[model samples]
Target: MHDHEEHDEQDSGGGAAAPARAKLFLEGRYRKLCRDLPQTVFYCPECKGHPRRRRGCARCEGFGKLTRDSVQELVGWVAGKAFGTRKHKFHGAGREDVDVRMLGEGRPFVLELLGPRTFQVDLAALEAEINRRNEGRLEVRGLHWTERQRVVVLKETPHAKEYEARVAVELAPGDPRAAQALAAARALVGTRHTIIQHTPERVAHRRADKDRERWIEFLSVELEPEVEPEVAPAPALDAAPELDAAPALDAAPALDPAAATAAANGADAAPARTYWRVRLRTQHGTYVKEVLSGDSGKTRPCLAEWIGAPCRCVELDVTAILDEHGGAEEVVEPAPADDAPFGTGI
Candidate 1:
């Protein structure tokens, strides 16, 4: 009985060993295949057709072995090998007009260095290496280890942006009408939706032509003032109490309940001075630019059409963009109770 039990134990041990041997054999085969496969041959531009030499040719300066696509591929390979990672994703804070250059602090960005085995790697050194390798055409900073999930927020956040743009306006010569129109635009109030018909000409290759609605809450314009000639000094101050007590012509009275109610409810009654330096807070996705230009009359009651003068935005900047899913309250006033019918003239 003892001999039979020992033999059973040995058979079970052999069964486990067989699978281990097989796994090792397969791994060895894979490594052998990788080694036996020929190293990819890159043409030497300097040598005119020959393979690259050990020291490399003087003419191409070893660049004969490099191509843009090949360099990218090598970067992926080295990053994977050194970090033992799968892949990486790069996220930009905001997209530039391809034609526009990002000058300051090079717009905030996040890079998802995925599946890294060496999470403890020195990030500053890695960033420096990458910047050196790219020769500063693209730069990276704020490099810190991050998780995959943060990439989602980086992509979705509606970050408020500031833009410095130079706009050109086409108006009829000697048209003071243009300035008046721009002023009227600033004083305009209330939320307005404008539908934009995106043209294929500008974004045809990358995006589909689609109609999108954007809301506008505020619009304003400023023009360089014409310098005035020197004028004589004004008269001396008046000491009369009557003059001091007299309300200043520019001063307006304190809040009138009726006027406040009207303004809150969006009545036709608006403050005087049609021209204003309009500053307003509005909803997200508002096409302030299209609202100013009218986009071929897609935006109705536009500043240009309203003032009977061509209008364009000189500078546009976003002060804030509220969270899309924010919650707001609507006030409900209590209704007055109806009087009961008198039973006997009580």
Candidate 2:
């Protein structure tokens, strides 16, 4: 995961000459095909992308990369071609994992055009071309010109994000434990929590290993309604039920509708597992994936802990990039009190 606001400072296409600059908000999704690509170009680590070494390198097949293209490449190719510039820097408000799709208002980004031959080209046209060239792979909106200062503000300012996660949760149907889990999940909504998070295992190599305080507020959580399956194939919508298919209520009363439906779909009589849709708002720098999974117990009081089940985020989408980085309250774990009896002396 790029952590959203990641960037690198690099030289312009024209070397010492000043580069043309612009700020545009990239509100786009990494569609199915491009999900594996990172937000930036990933050079071959084995060969360092060196031409001579890359030629003999089987890892990247001498192409200098393990894979083809990226979000930065796709946008840069089109914009750089229009500007006659080969180099540019990509700045994003925050970066999502390559597999996660960005939705809703999208993430903010600033493109440093870097020594364009001409600065008078129509931005709307360039935006269209970028979308058209990468139709299924990538898309963007709000292409316009702005100053270099916006880039600084984008990196320096912190912003929270809203995410929608489709999580697969498990619970034994018809067990008392299922009701307990449901109650636990419902109790979590409309509450604010401050938790201690150790660096997640996935990014531990790059991130500092220390306890960090992060906050999240659950806006809403909804469970998909369970459906009772029918023994026979369900009739098409708007079609009348066949009288011969089911016997009269008085004659076949032994099997009630509820019992009949349950018996028909008997896989222990319930679906047992279903998706739970979660909508939450988190502070900047908080890893949403780790928050849901508890990251092998590294994150305390997490969604997994609250639900009392193993939770896996199957689908994730950003709902918004909030402009505000709200004030954070410190996390203080209270010390346990002495267990002396009320009437007894210490």
TM-score each candidate: 0.41, 0.70
RMSD of each: 25.8, 16.4
Instruction: Tell me the RMSD of model 1 versus the true structure.
Output: 25.8
lDDT of 1 by residue, 1-346 (tens): 0000112222455463222110000000000011111112234545743544524677656555433332223334434545556564445433443223333333444443444555334444555565566453444444443333444654666543333333334543346765666555545645443444453244455565666554444433454443467999875577434545767877976899998998888796432122223344433434455555676765654556655655555544333223443223121111122222211111
The residue pairs in collision within model 1 are 215-286
* Model 2: per-residue Cα lDDT at residue 250: 80
lDDT of 1 at 15: 62
Count clashing residue pairs in model 2: 3
Reference-based lDDT, each prediction: 0.41, 0.70
Residue 149, model 1, lDDT: 42
